[model samples]
Target: MFGKSLKVFGILLLCISFTGCAKARYAAPEPETRVVGGASRAEAFRFTPSGDQAWLSWEQKPTDEEYGSFILKIGRANFADGSPLPLDTAVGVEVVLWMPAMGHGSNPVALEKIDIGTYRVSEVFFTMPGDWEIRVRRTTEAYGVEETALAIRI
Candidate 1:
């Protein structure tokens, strides 16, 4: 009886150890929203009128709808104190790219969907600007409408 009890205890210990290991190996995948906006989610580009042109780039996160729509709006502002201008008074602007059925909505340029969570390059031009705000309005099937804004100095 003693030997049988000892064997049962050892088996129980081994089962417990295996269960713990399995639990340790299991990890939930990071959410899509968190991954897309990793570091530059809210980051804005800064420019100083180099050669009368500046390159703008940003990341956009999409939902799991296979297809979605978004609107990109670029705003130009004349700042005196080096501060970012308000969203309401952004004038003298240009629409670099406008695409439909793509990840980004109406604009001047077309952005092709590269992968499930990535988008192609969308470029814009700033003509002698003091401050420019690059705004993206994304509409997903799951998350409705989301906005991402970036400010650049030129």
Candidate 2:
């Protein structure tokens, strides 16, 4: 009877020691902009569609109107090798915000060009947010179309 009780206590002590090694920790989210991209990216921006390129940086523009509405800027576009794109390179950009779970998108987004390789995007409305994706696309005659997506929660 003493031997059986001693073996049981030894097993219980071993189980308690293992449990302490597997403690879980809570992590707080970062406030910086993060984008999901493939290996073919320049700096923090993700450029896609392969070959000849364009890019969208993961920098958020501050908005004055409301919390749901925001602004974005598309700039510093370059080649896959990090070389500057030509000054006359014709480019068209479009921004879309959508919730994939609900299968719906927000209002129209305005794309305004300030200068060559520089653009000001506004009117990004989040409506109601659970999880949202901001799809930024750039189209050109040379490279066809290249796009990058940023997933965010509001």
Candidate 3:
């Protein structure tokens, strides 16, 4: 009985010591958002700009029947300061790919509204290896229209 009591006391002391040595906790930094064309931005989308590819996972709202679509959750990351500005009040989004060096562009592709703000585009393939630009035009509720381009090289 005495041996059992000592073991229990030792365990209790060890647990108490661990509890007393608590480490400070720090919160993660909030993602940065900017107001552009009267819209709020969030790190709700992710893409590898260097690869000349884009994948967005926006908040799913009702799918736009006019623009039938699919979902591709690419994860989330904040957009770098300036360039490729994201609009909050975007009601319509379109993507176009152009190869400046080759002096040509891929076939026209339409982006379908899959979820609320989530959009999916088909046939965005780079046929040749060279400099490419993906231009995006967003129809905003307040600003009327906003455009940004993502440059990439292969």
Candidate 4:
């Protein structure tokens, strides 16, 4: 009887020791922000600029090394009352690729206006592969700096 109790105690002690000596675990760091204003998690490939009247979308990313890295984007904007922006608004757009984990950004991208509301983003080079934020900005005298950002894992 004593031997049985001792065996049970030994098993319990062994289990307790194994559990008590477990190594501490750590988790990967989370992205500081989801998008633009840095609020809740954003899962958007399309976003609205600061003016809250413009919508933007990005396409053709994750470029290969052999081919030049570039991104294509499109936008549509309207006034406060939802009227489309005038043709003479003279809007300009730019793209900036930033890696938040490393606190660094890629080379300045070349912006080519494809049409009234479309652009071909070029020269977007990334040093390392990690989570990146693609910041898109549209500027006009009336809207000032209408900007938006989207987080993506590359």
Best by lDDT: 2
Superposed model 2: Cα runs more than 4 Å off: 1-43, 50-90
> Which clashing pairs does model 2 show?
none
Per-residue lDDT value at 118 in model 1: 32
Residue pairs whose backbone atoms clash in candidate 1: 70-105, 97-107, 97-108, 97-109, 98-107, 98-108, 98-109
Window of ten residues with lowest summed lDDT in model 1: 46-55
RMSD of each: 17.4, 9.7, 16.6, 11.2
**How much is 58 displaced in model 2, in angstroms?**
9.3
Q: Write the per-residue lDDT of candidate 1 for residues 1-154, one digit (tens) a residue.
A: 9999999999999999988877444563321222222444233322222111112334443333322223322223335643233232221233332222233432244455443333354433333324434444544344444444344443
Model 1 off-target regions past 4 Å? 1-107
lDDT of 2 by residue, 1-154 (tens): 9999999999999999998787456533322344332222332344444433334443343233442323334444454755545243446777788777799888877777766665556666677736777777777677677776666665
The residue pairs in collision within model 4 are: none
Ranking the candidates on lDDT from highest down gives 2, 4, 3, 1
Candidate 3 lDDT, tens digit per residue, 1-154?
Answer: 9999999999999999997787546543322332222222322322322221224322332122222222332222335642233223456667776777778886676566655445676645556556666666665455565554545553
Model 4 regions lying over 4 Å from their true place: 1-60, 67-74, 77-90
Clashes of 4: 0
TM-score of each: 0.31, 0.51, 0.43, 0.51
As for TM-score, the candidate ahead, 1 or 4, is 4
lDDT (0 to 1) per candidate: 0.37, 0.57, 0.48, 0.56
lDDT of 4 by residue, 74-149 (tens): 4334446443342334366778888877888987777787666545676666666667877876676776766666
